[model samples]
Target: MQNDTPLYQLDPTNRFTHRTQDYDAYRPTYPSAAIDAILEDITPQTVADIGAGTGISSRLLADRNLKVWAVEPNAAMRATGSKQPNITAWEGTAEQTGLADNSMDLVTSFQAFHWFKHNDALPELQRILKPNGRLAVVWNNRDRTDEFTKRYGQVLQSVSSKPVGLGRLSDATPIRQTNPYFTNLREISIPHQQALTLEALIGLANSRSYTPQQGAAKDLLHHRLAELHRAFANNAGIAYLQYQANIFLADPA
Candidate 1:
């Protein structure tokens, strides 16, 4: 892994605590086909969802009738997920999952892998995964090619005061190289989009890890958002947000 500071590491714990409501409200859920691709030949009985926040990914796995061991480090996020039935929510990080060795057939992380210390977590993943088990990393990335989306990104940067990392699929190369445990790394890109009102769009932005706006910054964020809404909002008063679900899968080396 590169030594560069990861955006997600900025404020690990409290970043999402305040926005948990909006997160569950506006954040896009992974597509069914995306999950289906990783879960090949494996029943619902053998799955471990590391960094399972708000049960978004965990509930999907559970819906497949598989028992889900939802491991999450954040207490607030874990509490949100605990309300779901049949989800075994554990307060644990990826590096120290507290799961038995070689017990899981599939170890999955959704929109959460980049937050982990991969060197410590990869070994834990290898320990929990059974022989020939699969490791899948899935992310729904924003498609900023659209004019409105591009402007929205600019608004985000202006408000957050953090460098918006690579905005293209090619920019994800470093993430693939972050760990050496997996071989046969393959990427599947699925075209996806979400239709959202201007308010929902702001909610989505607030839920991000790098959005540090508070007090005056928070007020300024809303001001900028209003300008974006006026500029981007169409006759229907809803903006079509485009995104691609990038699912990267590999097996133990």
Candidate 2:
């Protein structure tokens, strides 16, 4: 997601260090239905998941019995994800994965593509993907049509310095516009939802890079979110955050 924090204010790589726990604890996982849409009839033996925060999507791929290379630049996140069996977690960025050319049958970036310098990352992805290999970019976009969901967007925007992009329902317009090295762009959406407790809801807010972490903004965000939880949370102390898992699949052009 684009941030208003200019090149000077943004730490870029180190932003997620303190957020590792919240990310691992509260971040949602991609649906199996979305994964199936990306894989289709193909059977990939090796999959490289770039910008794999906490290995959420990587674990999903590994659970399908595929060898997963969980490439993440953050040491803290990589450490958390490495504990998962069948995942080779390591430090890597989308712009420079350092994987062998034509080595991977499939490459994916889940909720991380927007953070990458696509001009460089696309070529790098294209280089690593084998002939006819697929590249998938996926996001769990919040259902903003719901009243609570709309309120959540307002909360995020109120706190965020710039326009928040990840949770918004995407039509793949940005992906289609930015993709120069890939062709046959295909998109699929799978209905999904997550049950978040008050604490988890706060954790979800903290998990975002753009969310203010300290000072008055932080206090205000928390106060407003607590209010939201009070009004929208179910009897079980949970709020169902609806989402549509949007998957964009393409091949090297």
Candidate 3:
């Protein structure tokens, strides 16, 4: 999906280190079913995860016995992935992956494709993927229809509406239209939930690329979060945060 305003332009060097701790703490791991679905028709002997932050998705693929190359441009993220023996973390971007041509059986991006310069990255992906290889993109987005999720989303918008940019729903159709490499693009909507205390919710928000870390904005964020906690707290004092995992899968034509 094409957005008039970009969400966040991260500095490649500082991006991973600055957010590493929070990212490792708060980022949701992909469901095993999603991974299985992605690998169903195509048996990927070797896979490359572009923008593989902290190896969340890479680890999932690796668990399926796929040799995973966790390709991340950010140094700190690569460092984090290096600790995992299953994944070989490489420092690379989607546009210029250092891996040899036609070496990858699958090229995947999880919540990271939006960061890529598509014009440049598309050809790179095409080059790396073997014939009829799969290209899958997955995003876990808030299920704003639920009351708790709606309130949490409102708090996020109140904090930084500018950075959130246009809604993901609006962009999906256009993305399908513009990208010609994928012939049979299909979406799999998976229902998911995260049980969180107020503190955990705040940590999740803080891990986002657009969230402000300090000063008046940070104070405001905390204040709003407090209100959100008070408003959404349940009998057990924990909120059930609902999410929808929207996965788009296609083959490189």
The per-model lDDT (C-alpha) reads 0.77, 0.83, 0.77
Cα lDDT tens digits, model 2, 1-253, are 5444332234556778889888988888878898889889799999999989888899899988899999998888888744556789967888899899999999998987767766677889999999889999998888889888789878988987854444333445545875667888888889988888989999999988779989999999999999998999989899978888989998887
Error of 1 at 188 (Å): 0.5
Q: Model 3 lDDT vs. the true structure?
A: 0.77
TM-score of 1: 0.87
Candidate 3 per-residue C-alpha lDDT over 1-253 given as tens digits, one digit per residue, 9 for 90 to 100: 3246542353543645777777877777777788877888777789999988888888888888888999987877776633556689888888899989889889998987766766677788878998878888888878889998888877777777445443743234424775765557888988888887878888888877667888899889989987888887888878878888888887776
Model 2 root-mean-square deviation: 2.8
Per candidate, the number of residue pairs that clash is: 1, 0, 0
Position 31, candidate 1: lDDT: 79
- What does the lDDT come to for candidate 1? 0.77
What ranking of all candidate models by lDDT puts the best one first? 2, 3, 1
Q: Which stretches of candidate 1 lie over 4 Å from their true place?
A: 1-3, 6-11, 163-180
Give the best candidate by TM-score.
2
Global Cα lDDT for candidate 2: 0.83
**Could you tell me the lDDT of residue 169 within candidate 2?**
31
**Rank ordering of all candidates by TM-score, starting from the highest:** 2, 3, 1
